[model samples]
Target chain A: MTIGLNAFLIIAGLLFAIGMLGVTLRRNTLVMFMSLEMMLTAVNLALVAFSRYNGTMDGNLFVFFIITVAAAEVAVGLAIIVALFKRRQSVMVEHLNVLSR
Target chain B: MADLLFYLFAGITLISALVMVLMPNAVNGAMCMIVSFLGTAALFVLLEAYFLAILQVLVYAGAVMVLFLFIIMLLDVGEDSPAVKPAKLSIFAALTGFVILSGLVISLFTDPASLPATPAFEVAENPTGLSANNGIPFTTSAKSFGYSLFTKYMLPFQMTGFLLLAAMVGVIVVSKRITETEPEAETTD
Candidate 1:
């Protein structure tokens, strides 16, 4: 079958579902981060597909801002992960309940 | 040709996505995720969103994924800490996700094509990356976008910028504590 816009949309949805599963199933904080990125990628794919289908630049422009915010999120998220690791010497979600540190 | 590229990249994307989830090492999983992101970017190009495709490569794959990799390596999380899946919870979650995805696909196939028939704009190429495409853009749609960004959407844009600044401050504060705690490294003076 030809990979039309519909195909792309389906693939994006599948990716989003897989990402959601990863986020819910996995416990490692780092893997969770990767799953979050996967979610973002799925959204990006959806945006670009809609942009192409509608033949409008609006979705593409929105993707630009999403990219900006995603970058900032990663930088700050990594910093926090590093900080948390320094304190606990572990990156498991279950072991990170102490908010004070 | 397009279908070939799509299938190729889609296969790469799905496989890497599986690797991302199934990998034992967190660092390796993150790397697999990076590959998936690149495949997604290539798919974006095939979809004709050239600008979004470039931004995907530049920002998400290049910056965000790299940051993830850096943090993963920095923390050095490994095989010793095997990630456990809670069996009962995962089965429920997986079933829910599968049902949702099925619904989405069904709805998508049934959805009517009411999408507007506007001509796709040719994305300007600035390989040198020397100039701001924003300031020079004078197309009617480009002008409308600029107006919306500065007028209707101005508040949201400013809020996002402020949030980024706050995140930057937060990162700095957190990293500084790490530097101060290392007394032996401090004693190297």
Candidate 2:
């Protein structure tokens, strides 16, 4: 009844692919950001699975650092998004051409 | 039982994630993201990462998601805009993604036994002797986690604190308002 490591890895891969799809297809900045977070979560899952099967704590430690960095990233990324919305009055990625001129 | 739970959690995780992406309403998407995060936390628990499971719920589902919802409401991103037209590039992107996914599936399933074996540690040689009581050495208990964090990984831990501080400062700088009366600094130069 035990799930093997391969199953977890495969699930992680699928999740990562889904996240990549969201990033590529979505136009909204917030949704794109959420997709990026999804990708990170997938990576964390893979690391934990490896850690468990390897009987080590290194992967777990790496996951802890990733979670910390992701929190900071969310704070700053949301702030940037808010600023962009104020300037352009839209959160659509298509509208973001500030550097193009 | 564990296999069943794994499948359940995995199903929840993937479904919610798909919903998050497919839902047009940003609010609904955020809610789905929360559910996905919860499913991920459940998977973490099954992996024996207890601390991370709690942190995932608290940090991702509890805090980060609330932040996203707050912004979604504050901006008032109503359903005013129509769905974006799919450009030609979207097809290319989808094709590329599919190719990558297929490659990963092939390699992973091709040689299942090539996966690294879980490192085995002798119970008698455990440094802290904490596992001696349970007869399971190398278990990543919170105590051992703390031990490794403070001793072996202290530098990276400190660096993460610095990174957070820098992010906080950057956020403040980026979000600060520029008054209309102020001269256009870039143009003036």
Candidate 3:
């Protein structure tokens, strides 16, 4: 029962959808950030699967870059969240209404 | 056996990811995310990407998640408010996700033979010139990965280093506390 490329892809898609749902429904900024990381991981999975199937190092290399970028993103994003929390005393997205005005 | 492992890892990855999202407590969600990353690393191992599998665990599960946990603990974020209902925005997001997923599935199955065959490379070390079982030379090995990273992908690698440096500086700048004397001086002025 070898797993086909399509199966891996479909799994990635489902994981991505779940992450999207979390991002949309969750109001807590930290939870939303975690969901975004889930989405990034899903993409990395797909990239690795394709690399394995295609027998190329390109995809694997790209995955390395993606992971690096993701780490940087998490750093900056969490810092912003911390700053926002300090200002408002909360991490809820609703309290971040200053941008709208 | 490989198929079973794939399913097991996939199940772990998906279930833990869902748990991360659904858990109201940020700390629990971060813990679930760690499990999810571990499962992903296992899947990477199954994919024959051994280097990436280790890196995933080290960077994501070990470092990034620790950072997330530290922030969550430091901020002391509580459970989400129960008052905020799932609004129409959630429905819209769900619909969009469904549509994108269907499109991806359709395109994936549309052309079965569209995927390129795995390219085979001759092994210099093998005396009989027999290709590996996967028909590709040992490209996934750490040596080849490093060689390619330094030679073929050098520029991007350097750029990634710069990006990390910039991100570190940005984090410090953003998270720095405002001094009381500065605010007092501004108020007096």
Candidate 4:
């Protein structure tokens, strides 16, 4: 009944798929962005799993850098989203109805 | 007990992520995301990544979720807006994603061929030495991460500093409002 590598890997893969589905299906830009973050977290989980199983700091360190980059990405990305909202007045991707507004 | 915990946390993560996807209100979705991240952090702890668990809670569940919530509220998107018809291409893509996930699950769980020959040994039981074969032992201690980040990964670490600085400046400039006199607001792209 002990968990193994496959169990962790499968769970990570499932988490990633959920995120992928979310991003594609959601209309709101912010929800899609949150889904993107979920995808990133899923990958980090897999990497941590590998690090634990393989007994390496390399995966963990890679995750460390990923976290740093993700924080920066969130700040910049949300700024862009805010700007989008300012211009279009809607954060739903479908509402961006203009071809060249 | 460990198996039960693993499934519990994994279920928490996947289900919350699903809720975040399907939730109509952005604020509710953000809340679900926090739960999902916390579940992942718990999984990290179960995997023996103590420092990563802490970082996951602090950086992801703390700072990132706060930023998301603030933006969601600032935007104040219409929660009652029904799901717009997703583009046909997007529906195809989502279906493809589901197919891929199902295939992975089948191949991984039902078939022993996909399983590893050797069981994964726990790092807590037998720590691996660095590839450089240096004196540094691989451990999940925060101090160990500091040593590795400083010594072996110095260049990239410094680059991360630059990236963060650039992001800060970009966010400020990108979000700043222009005066009515400036033509910058007029140019739409």
lDDT, each prediction: 0.72, 0.83, 0.81, 0.83
Ranking by DockQ: 4, 2, 3, 1
lDDT (Cα, tens digit) per residue for candidate 2, span A1-101: 45777778877888888888888877888889999999999999999887777666778889999999999999999999999899899998767867785
lDDT per residue as tens, model 1, A1-101: 24556677778877887887787777788887778888888888888777666544556667767877877888887888888888888888778767756
Best by TM-score: 4
Candidate 1 chain A lowest-lDDT run of ten: A52-61
User: Candidate 1, DockQ to 2 decimals?
Assistant: 0.46
Instruction: Return the lDDT, model 3, position A9.
Output: 78
Q: Would candidate 3 be rated incorrect, acceptable, medium or high by CAPRI criteria?
A: medium
Fnat per model, in the order given? 0.48, 0.61, 0.59, 0.71
Give stretches of model 2 more than 4 Å off: A98-101, B78-80, B110-137, B180-189
Tens digit per residue, CA lDDT, model 4, A1-101: 36777788888888888888888788888888888998899899889887777766778889999999999999999999899888988888777768856
DockQ of 4: 0.65
What TM-score results for chain B in every one of the models?
0.63, 0.78, 0.75, 0.81
| DockQ of every predicted complex | 0.46, 0.56, 0.56, 0.65
Task: List, in order, the clash count of every candidate structure.
Answer: 0, 1, 0, 0
Stretches of candidate 3 off by over 4 Å are: B88-138, B180-189
What TM-score does structure 3 among the candidates reach? Answer: 0.84
Per-candidate TM-score against the hidden true structure? 0.76, 0.86, 0.84, 0.88
In candidate 4, which residue pairs get closer than 3 Å at backbone N, Cα or C atoms, i.e. clash? none
lDDT tens per residue, model 2, B1-189 = 888899999999999998888788889999999999999999998887888999999999999999999998999884426766657888587769856885776587557576753433322223363242332234546776777778778999999999999999999899988777757776787
**Candidate with best DockQ:** 4
